[model samples]
Target: MMRRSLTATPGPARLRISLAAQQNGCASGATEVTSARAAIATAQAGLTAAAAADTAARTRYLAATQAVAGARKTMLRVQRQRPYRSARVAHAKSAVAIVTKTMITRRAQSGKATAALTAARTGLSIATTRLAGATSRWKTTCAAVKVTQQKLTGTAPTAELTARAAAISRDVVTQVRATFTTADATTVYGITVHRSVAFAFQRMIDDAKADGIVLSGGGFRTRQRQIELRKINGCPDISTAPASSCRVPTAIPGRSLHEIGLAVDITSGGKTLTAKSAGFAWLKAHADEYGFANLPSEPWHWSITGS
Candidate 1:
């Protein structure tokens, strides 16, 4: 299967493509797991055959022992007669030892057959377990496939789709002049973040402080601020250039997570967190616990999502 990665920031079409690719991989895995059913059937057949052979060997051993007993009794009865030296009597005496040896040999054969049967049973058990695991994985992945399908499916009319997208944008980006309105903002450790994330952000900071790792950061930039930062940072395009393309790695207007009040450029001792910073290490270890994820490209940039 071909593996495709999602773009740094996926648009709606890219999102659909990534999900469809995932669905294809999932369906392929499902197909591969179904082959385990054939292995299970094969193992069961081997067990059945081994069991039948072991049963036959055991029955043969039992019959051989019974034969030896009958021969011994016949030989004893013949020896009690005056003409005990007869050929028939001698043969009966010989038959007892011969049948006894045969019984011993059959016993050894039965033991070997039983060992083979045990091995077969173990093989069946292993195959059963393998099948079960594969089946479970198949179910889980196929369920994931269903989710990807849901993600890829575009059932809404084009007009409704555009309208809904616009509506969502309006809900998320309520303004462009300044930071989020008071109703949407909450203060956390001197930084204003989305109200939904404020509690977690504060808790993370308090916990970090307890660990002797001071946490401070900037958050919640307005679209105007984003544009200003872009110009200051020398982004190629005012609105479309990637953050990574800017001279100072600044996001373009409307593209900055800061505009959403979900991202923060964390600092320690009033300096941005770096790879060597203790505060960065602490966040790496514990930030996810508070629903914060770091963007790998910028160690100091953290948000509800890593992007």
Candidate 2:
């Protein structure tokens, strides 16, 4: 088919006729198809961009979840080993390191290994500091305990009297009774007196107590032990009771070590030796030199050099 070009004529009637045909026919509308196609292309571009964004967000969320899970697992494993003790920290660190390496190797895409490494390092640093403190405390406590045990084992005055002598003296007085006319009645040390020994023992106790042998409020157990031995062994005071009966009660009617003055009570309390009395302190430090050993149960009691 051949197409013809239409030309405008200079006549009002012809222009009117052309306008009427254009309004009545579809051939006159030509640009609407092109505009519709352009709109469809723009909508497709927007949809593609939105889908890509959603995919990226999903990937990021998944990665974060994996990282958190790895961190929690690592923490649980480390905590299980009890890292509070210094001796165990090395093991904890090694365990954390191994777990971190494994996480990195197995989950390469999530950066799990890097996160695990950071957590492990932080945990190890804190654990090391705490462990050091705990170790130091343990050592200090052990040392204190050892010293206390040794002190308990050292000899005191109660080791001196024979069983028979002790029984006889105990029957007389049951315990030593002493009073200082010038000062308070205080305990001194333990001596082996039984109304039968020689004058030498009582002299030692007299000299020690008169010279202020007991320290005020020293070791209580050691002092008390000494006192019990003195009482049971018939220790002396400045009283006028016969020296022979000093170690034995006056009621026993037999010659006691106190009569010979060979035993003395030097304890003030149980498990303690006082520092306030020079005599008591001297006994604690020098009693061994005189062949005297402290009794664990009674700090004040002592046996003779050979007995």
Candidate models: Cα lDDT each: 0.74, 0.40
What clash count does candidate 1 reach? 0
- Flag clash pairs in model 1: none
lDDT digits (tens) for residues 163-252 of candidate 2: 333444344332332321212123333432333222223334443555565322221123334445446667464234443455532212
Error of 2 at 52 (Å): 1.5
TM-score of each: 0.44, 0.21
| Candidate 1 Cα deviation (angstroms), residue 13 | 6.4
Give candidate 2 regions above 4 Å deviation: 1-29, 85-307
Residue ranges of candidate 1 with Cα displaced over 4 Å: 1-21, 86-89, 152-307
Residue 32 displacement in candidate 1 (angstroms): 2.9
lDDT of 2 at 81: 61
